[model samples]
Target: VAVSVSATASHPIPSTLWGQMFEDISSGDGGLYAELLQNRAFQQVTPNTTAALNAWHPVNGATLSVVADTVPVSSALPNSLQVVIPAGKTGPVGVGNEGYWGIKVTAGSTYTASFHYRFPTASAFKGSITVGLQTAIGHSLVSTPVPITAASTAWAQVNVTLRPTASASSTANNFTITLDGAAASGQTVHFALFSLFPPTFKNRPNGMRVDIATTLAEMGPSFFRLPGGNNLVSETVAQRWQWNATVGPLLSRPGRVGDWGYINTDGLGLMDYLNWCEDVGMEAIMAVWSGFALGGTSVAEASLGPYIQQAIDQINFVIGDPAKSSAAALRASLGHAAPFPLTYVEVGNEDFFASSTYTYRWHDFVTALQAEFPNIHFIATSNTFNPILSPNPLQYDVHVYQTPTWFAQNSFFYDGFERNATTYFEGEYAAISTNSSDIFGSPATGRLTFPTMQSSSGEAAFMTGLERNADIVFSASYAPLLNHVANSQWTPNLVSFDAGAVYPSTSYYVQKLFSLNRGDEYLPSTLPNPTGTLFWSVVRKTSTRQIIIKISNTVGTAAPVTFVLPFRTVASTGTAQVYLFPFTTVHDFDVWIPNRC
Candidate 1:
């Protein structure tokens, strides 16, 4: 059944049509080995099989709602956008809603809009902001407007840059967010959010510029399962993702309306995604959707105790001990009082589409959050996996979007489950094609790829079969990490990068070459000859026998690799560290090339 046919992997110049598919390779525990180096780089930003709906401003809030329709609406603000008079929203109820906010744009793509303002610093205060090109249905495709003025009233910010002009078209299905409040009315100014940015896709920011620690060091992510998949749930229960209306000072944080049709701009909440996983090092795995929901709704089991006290106040505001109270005064008003190591939370996300996450309104919020955090670590995305929906020891969190050779022929479907020390969390997998529509609400259509890389090297050959089954795959990422490449609802994404520059994919160098060439230990032995498209995997370092090769060809063509020395007396003595991720190339987020003996 290798007889298959596919058409539109589309190519005219997808950076010079891919390359070499396969050749020589042998080694599975046979002491896995490969000594071929041909340009290797690394990066991160792959995850969006379904979960980042309206994933803007980090995850939920900081700013992003700039718009303009005009009429007393500060003449439709835009000089890259800037307007601040917020001493107190006044004069006609802050000029009713205002207008102008449809940012879908994407003609050559490279936008970066902004907004945030405040006035009255007296002899040292100034203000201004304006950006143009509207007219999808409203107006102002530049009837002249592009002012952003402000030195500092305190807020300060009004960046604007647009290149849209190849006759400029395709707003990629028109969108809107426009906002304006009649210039300094009653001179009490107070409009805090505003944004617009496209073409950063997956690295995040569709309607609000992003910079989160240089997009998490080119997404060299380690683990960030937080609020992932279904964006951590909230289609109902009166629209969730609250976390105190999404944190401070950006209009005192009050932005939610999102299941991802648009309007999230919470600038990403929960202490700005745990200080954005401590500025890009990553490791937050914070899911808490429990209490059941995809849409089936459940709090039963005699009111699953306020959904297990909102999962113990979202783990005492992420790792407790902010000092105690009001979640440690909202973590000292978001400047961080510390406390954010979080082992794992993950209560719900896929909630079994509707089977209800592990039962009883999600196993009583994971048995009252492991009975009040008894050493953390609790997960459960469920739709299938069931430890009887666990009531105690947790960790399941699976999810798939399918395709790419059925994810390289089932990549050994969990080797054979039943590990009972129970563990695994691929969380949200991908490939998504066949039209991919079904994202929770079900109807089905995805097969993955909202960004690009021939479907992220078939999701880097199923993350090289989840790093040849890391123990049993303890953690994994790649689920709606982001999407804004032209209002992209979802598609191939794994580090498209922005701001300065970034680009990774050959499926994010298959976990940046298996998380910087891992090898804690795993070497049974015996493998060689599955050469359909080279899929090597082995690890050994019991002190230092060295040896850790992880190759995944994904059959694009060029792979004349050669290796077979499990240790016939260590000849060709140590040393070899290849990390190739080519198929025309863009992979340079990690890029490491070292091979000598």
Candidate 2:
């Protein structure tokens, strides 16, 4: 580490340096995940019984049972829940679903609830159905009753408009559907494929959860790394995220078992993600499903052609000329006629885990996708193994998950590294605290994690390294961005929320502050001692002509330091507002409240 306090000059830094990562991992209702109904299509399976109904409970004298679909219907789910209101049953008897924990309903807002149903008999069943929101104890509010004069004997969809009263509580409400006058001695109605959604982000059908999307939009991310982390390539080859399986009609999408021990609705499909990016003013950094699976299974070279072509088609659908290719035409039919802009295409996620065959696999994908989509740049998983054999990648994805002390100590990890044509993307990195109560906190039962000062200080220190080497590190994003408190798969997420409120972690603020103040050019600065206790980066904004100095002090006591900008004249009025994040105890990292800082 060399330092010359006299030489304080500025150089160039890339503007595309910081962004966010969003994945489907126990994202709360009305949070990042859009699907309100947990087991919407009833695609549940367990050891005890095949069709396992997890989140749903019987309501008002109704008996719930999962039955296999005897007859196959076009694009219908395999299993359906049978609600039996006994012949002598009194009052409204039906089923209720506690959405992803609980349904979030706003006062005076209309929610669209729909379900598919069919009768056991061939005769047209005459009945009435009421769908609405209610407390867990059966106190009802805002019920929409629809008369079913004669529904089809085959699978038919029913939709109802529900508007909660102005006084209805927005939290801890459940979405329920009740059937009346349909309980006959020999008569029974079958129901399946239930769905309930609030007004989405842009009021688009099958859209994003509004509140979650707004949160990400506020962060002002440069790009959205869509579809997932290990989720892109699951443990099983059958469960890998297939773009084709996740598009178009909802019923047609056969949701696969997610890598994180749950089912993915794919309700937030590729088009939906692109629309979200459009709404948030970010580009798409799409990750294609490479032939490698996390379970250490790589598709043999002879049969890897289809997967490579799928990646090409995904690119074609996004950026290729619509008039020329069927893939692009399909994109047009999906309502995004004009191709969305995408600069980086990641071949696979964490493929370096299988380094034995990764280079060859990378070659296969790069050779096919790069030749066709010459305009788009490609990124590899990691450079841990062999240097990329052929068709060099533009950037390499690097991931680091370590303790806060490790991150703070390694703040200068990339200092004076060889400058090469290939840049770096820290796609998934976090100062994890798996053993601390701030993060793990009774890991056996706890599902949500909070960011502590120890963790955040480490993250800030590491980010200063990225800021210092912005020319080499083109972009970076924190991993597992949003976590639903009830059913999270990963810990130390950026944001955690239940049905009621959102808690942005300490690290979230660190990332937000960095993102909001990303300077255009790097400035050289010399420290007096250059100790590990302090980490900082100096850069200048090309647009504002502001000299920004981001400093992170990890030590216990603060030391007064003075700066001398020799090359430029200093003005007292040029000082901008100082943003300081004071340190707090690790135990107090539970959540963020207004004015807590």
Q: Compared with the true structure, what per-residue lDDT tens digits does model 1 show for residues 563-582?
A: 54433244344445444434
| Stretches > 4 Å off in candidate 2 | 1-11, 28-30, 44-51, 71-73, 167-170, 181-186, 385-388, 434-448, 527-531, 567-571, 574-597
Candidates' RMSD to native: 21.0, 5.1
Measured against the true structure, the TM-scores of the candidates, in listed sequence, are 0.31, 0.90
Provide the global lDDT of candidate 1 against the true structure: 0.46
> How high is the lDDT of residue 323 in model 2?
93
Lowest lDDT 10-residue stretch of candidate 1:
27-36
Q: Candidate 1: where are CA atoms >4 Å away?
A: 1-191, 197-225, 228-252, 255-286, 289-345, 348-364, 368-390, 394-418, 421-423, 426-475, 478-496, 500-502, 505-507, 511-597
Residue 364 C-alpha lDDT in model 2: 87
